[model samples]
Target chain A: MDERFALVGLCPAAEQAAPKGRRPGKRPALAAAFLALMVLGCLLFPLLLTKDPASMDLSNYAREPDGTFWFGTDTMGRDIFAMIWSGGRVSLSIGFLATALSTVIAVAVGAVSGLAPRWLDALIMRLTDILLSIPSLLVIILLQAALGRANIASLSLVIGATGWMSVARVVRTEVRQLRTSEYVAAARCMGGGTFHILRRHLAPNFLASIMFMVVMNVRGAIVAESTLSFMGAGLPLDTVSWGSMLSLAENALTAGAWWIVLIPGLFLVATLLAVTELGEWLRRSANRGQSNL
Target chain B: MCETLLDVRGLCHSFPLGAGRYLRAVDGVSFRIRKGEIFGLVGESGSGKSTVARCVMNILRPQAGSILYRGVDVCDPAQFRANRRMLQTERQIIFQDSSSSLDQRMKVADIIAEPLAVNHIVPPRGSLRAEAAFQLRYVGMDPAYLDRYPPELSGGQRQRVAIARALTMEPSLLVADEPIAALDVSIQAQIINLFRHLQAEHGFTFLFIAHDLAVVRYLCDRVGVLYRGKLVEMAPTKELFDRPLHPYTKALLSAIPIPDPRRERARTRFHFDEAAFDRTGGFVQVSPEHFVLGGKEAEP
Candidate 1:
């Protein structure tokens, strides 16, 4: 039998047909449920925050925590809670949007590269390697510098452009494997064209790997955007990003106005952790589904 | 066996090895499968048996070959495409390891209906469920199994589903590549018997590829022996088994153990000297419809 055509061997009937007794443990769905709620809460928080993210009270600059402000005030006397919520909207959205864009780019490039003839596959993978070898953050920085200051769209394009190489490489390997699978040949036997094979046979099987990459990249994108903001390359100073808030609080840190940096930093950490955890959970769930088959 | 439906002539395929080396995987193999005949292709691993099957199905192009279906050259891409619908409807492949052959995400019904969907034989919005149900029952699968995913099926059941899926196209040729090798021994016999029964009922031609001679003997009416990349010997099943002319064929046959260990010990032990196996010679017809190549008999 062709190794490429070897069955995934996890079919549902495989379990029933096996002369065995014990079944494997399935993934607990609660973790995903909790993570989903957290993501929804984060997504909706900015929309719920009534005050303008940049709206500042000059009289209350650097004020300590009080009943009026749940998270006290930043250097500009902006409500830390409101700013964090609003900044989170940009950070999280950019992360996900950029990750999605990159995933599409990578999957397309990789699948094409992998399924193409040997020379073409090598060409695409070599291009991927060259892109992957360069420091992604440096590429983003260079692009941002050359292309001008960071708006959400520009930042996303830069991050997305640099991020696709890894995904392309991963998807390329998967495509290479899938291109030779029996179902793929079956589709061909049914007179399916290359596009049909790509759309039906190759794409769906590798979607899980792509999704996992997207989730991980979201964390990376968020952190990248925050880093850009800290360097004064991201959203405008008045935009009240968590990064800009951190930038503003840097001077106040020595004066013991700790809430200026601490709260926003915690928020960034939580968001990254939440997304990473969510990605890991999704990967495990997919694996469990395979084993159950 | 019935009237010949597919005629393959002088098929040769060679792939470029690194550093300008040429590795031949299929060398001048030729055979004719009659309509409703079970033609077995037997070889060890790397013997090019699967490659031959691929060439017959046009999954892999042969550098020098002509596959004639009803006297039409199927090797030509344009002609093959022109007859694509007929090809799909008249020929199908049942792959080894049914789970891998089936799309994991698809339900049993959807998997069976894929050919129909792709060919547009069934309307996009038509009663695909009923069609899927009909195909399922054709392979002895229960209609209730339709809603279930591939993963829920056992190996024997999955192979049966694979057979059903292939037969759904109403193909005259079913290229089953090591269909039962991935299955357990106990289940292998059942799958083999099911194939036999289906062939008996449907009168479908089968290009059954396998490394197992015993199984091939049970399933095929005519047998072709593949060695490395060459078709070393081909004859009617009984003749090929009784009088294997090629050294490779003789070696392969000797390796098949007789059912009783005591009788097996008494059988001649053929030496498969790899050094001698690598030597090459062109095929020569020794008897009517029987050929042998790369041995002292052919050389002299």
Candidate 2:
């Protein structure tokens, strides 16, 4: 974006338009707005696009981008533009599903460890440490291979299962701090149930920590899927994910069809940037009155 | 009204300072609150006043003690579990720092009504919101503050909301641990008056803890004076104030500042002699409704 701004900066009209000192809320809102639009476009991919992304048109195969075909066509004659959007739907779904799964696990572990007695807290933390010692990507691949399925759903489950350890550590630390808070003591004194305290007292207080974690997990899941599919372990080519879309990059490289690789890679990188910017923004706000995770 | 509502016997608590050592916060401190009576525990800072209050409210499990609330031993795990809801519901605590004591994210209405909703008790006033509003009004606060959060309110307002929260359960026992210690001088009197008015009208039993002698004398029915976590004196408030028996109690009373500069400068202030202090001293009754800890041997 800054590069584009610099290019536009050569023109005086554009230089006059770009204002500085936007309030803290504005930048994140712009990023969130872009993400929301991208998500909407991906979700409504079928409704917006007329071409069948999977169907081959041998005569128009491997053509350069033109007025009719925005991202041109891949070697198999599949529309690269349609593939990017449709694959985005899969990528974002994995991000959302994996994020939800990991968040639930993270909160549960964090709450338990944070509120538990010293020895028990040590035990839980040590277990997390052991899990953290092992590389998560390797574990996800091994789990996926052992399950004998590389489908999108199972892949998300595997990624999610492996992703919660770090966030859980953050949550446990946050919860430990929050447990000493007077309101929690007051809530306990009122005879609120454990679940009630967790939901009512603990959740809202540690929400910022969890929000940043959730956003980062979405970004992580997307990258993990892309990496795994770029390798041979992710969803099959038929599933049409961004990772699977990228998996065909080697073939496109051999065929010298640059659009097929560059278009999807550019979209994925841009999406990752927006997601990362939003996560960092949330992290900065969370840090205003809290310890950084 | 004369019946004991809460009885604490041999309360002793210590926090481990690591290195196999303990810092005893409360040691063998015991007092009773009769039904519909105000019982004040007065002590200097680090004198275990808050510890005693926390032990009574069952927020901290004492190392050695039996707290009998309504004649049930709350320290025994099985017995406490059996009557846990009753004990917890009937006993509420108002912590000193109400801004932190009250959930900051929760609105005033939710803060007050949380105990009702959590315990699944049907509100007597038709709805929890109504109960909350009534509690707010009872605490001399308008229902208009219901939508506001704790951070938006002043320290005194937050303390009032804390009181209102405790009152929603219509708790028979209210443990106020230095509730006004964090308030300004003017706000302290307002809160003290509010507490006095609330108790007179509702007859709620109170276990008030404070370092402020004047407020305790004005508000409490009976007073217990603690010196270094030991109960040095116990008597009715008027009796204790007028005729303090122990040397430490005398020293404590003397510490209260006199208003007039003439009397204040000329007043004889008693100082406690640590050489004369004895931890082995047992309670000895010198007069009706009055007891002093020293001048007697340890009793079996």
Candidate 3:
């Protein structure tokens, strides 16, 4: 009987062939290029522009765009072009730093909660649920108000603290699913410790999800930082940011100096768009990589 | 009599189904695997054969039972923790789904080397590579395939890689849960042969779980028939095949289609009636080395 069953067929003919040549699509490429250029411009813009963004020129207050002031003077007579570049640095840094802090915390908390004992997992998950239920903007505002001042560092910290809940949820779900996989069971049978199974098996499998979360969180942090600044709870008055610039342009809009609001708004919208496009591209590519596996 | 390598006594495990309901996965299962022997646990899907394997492997702790390996009671938490390293080194498992059983992100060489590395049995770099290559060759794959990932390999090749990984630990016992169930028919024979060869060479005991009787009969020395999480019958493979004592065993045997067309057409299968029997009773020994459940008899 065994021989008959054995001789019934050779190897299955429809074996999964290796994936063929893969190339990055055009949209992601353009998005990536744009992001790179923006980052480079942010880094080099302040040095290349001769005027300091914060230096008020009361003599030239509310000047229109000319060769001397590419983006015109704001209500305070600061160079809008230099202020825009300087603001870009602050916004980008806050975004990057906040994303980094949140991702680290999320990965650690998520992995532990997912792989922890039943009681601990329940406790952690309940805590996360509570955090998720609260309005994040309100929490950030309360934190900023309590702290009494919103600097670049404090604003980044506030955004990071509020933003990790979603990432934690994503990682927790992924880890929980991975824990039940046969490989994890096999690892356990082979006498693998909890740390070993988590580090070697679960972590690598869920890395793509983690990466996707980090990128998405960066965009979230940028928006959160801008919102805080727009609401007059962001950086100090002397420090210029896209959000602060928009806030300052409110009075100028009544006087019809539209460039003050439009220029900074354009920067914010373009950066956000680029980031969203890049994140979408990353998610698609990660999915493709997973399907290939 | 051969020395007993493993003895499981009255193993019981259950899963909660919410609202205070429970699904009994393994109920009062008892078995022993002698050294240098292959013990087969055969049952239909969802009959809890895999659960038994997991219980024996210590992957899942049985709510009520004692599992003794080499005369050490592994069911005791203290003993299990104290001897964990030794037990882990001695017992390993090969899973049914080879693709999922392997880490997708890892290369083949890393997958095989993981057990050794995690156990801190780090050989020098050259020797480690050599050892991985050796196991690959032993499993009938070329060394060049080590750099590739699990997704790149065929199912048979992936199973072979899994087997190679298991062998890397040099385990005294291997709990194979439907190891060949996912393979092609032709590949199944080859893997079965590989198991046989490896057993002969290493003298390792195997707890082979499968739903296919023909394959179990080909590989195992002793066969235990599990029906709905209970051991209904157990005997030497040949005896069980020749004279199946339990009604479920008879039904299983009849279900194996004969190769001859006339006999295959003429065969009458016995349908099991679950409502007819008292499943709570213990096994009754009908003959030496043969046991049948749900009959009045003297206890061993």
Candidate 4:
């Protein structure tokens, strides 16, 4: 050993208490719990509700909360309490379905581009770049108009189609890098087939890299669906949803019924915040211990 | 069995630098490895040692030359495809950096058993985990680490796992490209000793690439000195160390430090002059097992 290093005698383990790859902070925990409650309530609580979300009561139209109404009524006199959870089913489902569609499209595009020859890869990347360069809202509106009248299914498809470009680029870069990593080359030398390498080595890493994106895509899809509905691009006014409720409540806003829009808006922002926090936590957890390697 | 397990004739390769330029990494280099013998290739950084190793392992295709392993010409795409499984099974390579060479996502057991799983071969030890454990123990590793990922282990442990993974296939030819270069000095000795034991007991053929002449002398049956992508000298280990002929080889050997203070002070370094190097000279056979470049034909 060098005499200089020997004299230092190695610093004691004073910094050991700092720990490595810490757990998610308090905010993520609270967000996770909130999301869990929302999902459970939205998925199951409507089954027990006696009041119909679509039923109207003109006598209590836009009335403040009373003994009979928990969240009061909107301009249509529809019960807001019943509407929130019931509409939650539509909004949440569309969000998740759109997220799934976008994820599938992104994975396929990324993997194909990552594995393709130089020319084809360049072509695919150029297409993604062009799509990313455009404003996603304009594309979504244009797609919704082109796809005919929008419902939950078409709304999700449009939102998913427009949102996949960024995630695909991210996935493509990661796939290209991991595919050429030395270990993958070693596996190839051992005659490990494409499927074996993908399933055993590549898939795990891809999952870690995309977990955050996948969660964020859900939030993006929900927001996109809301924006479309609010702009009268899709979802007929009859079907109940947070966005359609906001649209119907527009007249109520002019009538000085603040609770009509504020309640659903609060729910939307809360869900977005919760989802973002949980996504960040998932991303950190997936990437933990990586630098140590 | 045939004596010559591997033979390379006039191997050459170059990489394009774009704009119609080329970097000649390896030029007409050739050597043969007999079955069960350790062949050491010593060279400085950027001398194309890794490229040569990659060519031998079929990881890189040489532009010109033929590589015959077990009488199969692996350079031909058709021939290689036809015997891909057999060729892949019988030869394996260990890279220098274990961190990059071993899949961090895989458990040690999976990494060790991957070749068998890929080849559809039933484990000789009854089960995959059992086979993995046996190989792990064989390479001087604890079986308890079978469930651990590569990131969880120290550098030496990871290299040991890499060795175990390579050995699991029971390959006939193992190419190690400076495997000990990234290890600590204490770990280097342990790894070298382990390699020596593996060769002496199992009669494993090895292609060991290194610039450390001392380790090459201690482990290699024969030595080949590379200078700027060309083999300058090749001979039996003892013969090469005692009498290095080429200027580059002399300079390379002179750099080894003697342990004794008096001898270390008395030693004079041989300076290699690049300008004096004869690029057109062919290899001349000075003895049955010795060859040197830029030399007159022997009086024989």
* Per-prediction DockQ: 0.30, 0.24, 0.39, 0.38
CA RMSD for every model?
5.3, 10.1, 3.7, 4.7
Task: Please estimate how well model 1 matches the true structure, expressed as its whole-model Cα lDDT.
Answer: 0.80
Q: Which residue runs does candidate 3 get wrong by more than 4 Å?
A: A1-27, B124-127, B294-300
DockQ (model 1, Cα): 0.30
Candidate rank order under TM-score: 4, 3, 2, 1
Residue B84, candidate 2: how far off, in angstroms?
A: 2.6
Predicted complex 1: CAPRI docking category: acceptable
List the TM values for chain B, per candidate.
0.92, 0.96, 0.96, 0.97
TM-scores, all candidates, are 0.87, 0.90, 0.92, 0.94
TM-score of chain A of 1: 0.84
Deviation (Å) of A4 in candidate 4 = 36
The candidates, ranked best first by DockQ, are: 3, 4, 1, 2
Candidate 3 per-residue C-alpha lDDT over A1-293 given as tens digits, one digit per residue, 9 for 90 to 100: 23332432223324355566554554577778878987898899888988999999999988899999999999989999999889999999999999988988888999999988889989998999999899999999999898877888888888888889888988898999999998888788777888998888888878777777789888888888888787787887688888888887677898789888899999899888888888887777666644654
Kindly list the per-residue Cα lDDT of model 1 for residues A1-293, writing each as its tens digit: 22211222212222255545343433435545655655676678867877666887889888888888888987777888788777776777788789888988988898789878899888878888888899887888889889886688888888888888887888888888988888888888877788888887788778777777878888888888888788787777886666777777567787689888898998788667777677776777666556865
lDDT of 4: 0.86
Runs with alpha carbons beyond 4 Å of true place in candidate 4: A1-27, B297-300
Candidate 4 lDDT by residue in tens digits, B1-300: 439999988888899999999888888888888999999999899888999999888888999999999889999999999999988998988999999888888899999999898888999999999999988777776678888889978888888889888898999999999999999887888788889877776687999999899999999999998877788889989999987888888899999999999999999998989888776788888988899877752332
> Fraction of reference contacts reproduced per prediction?
0.48, 0.49, 0.51, 0.52
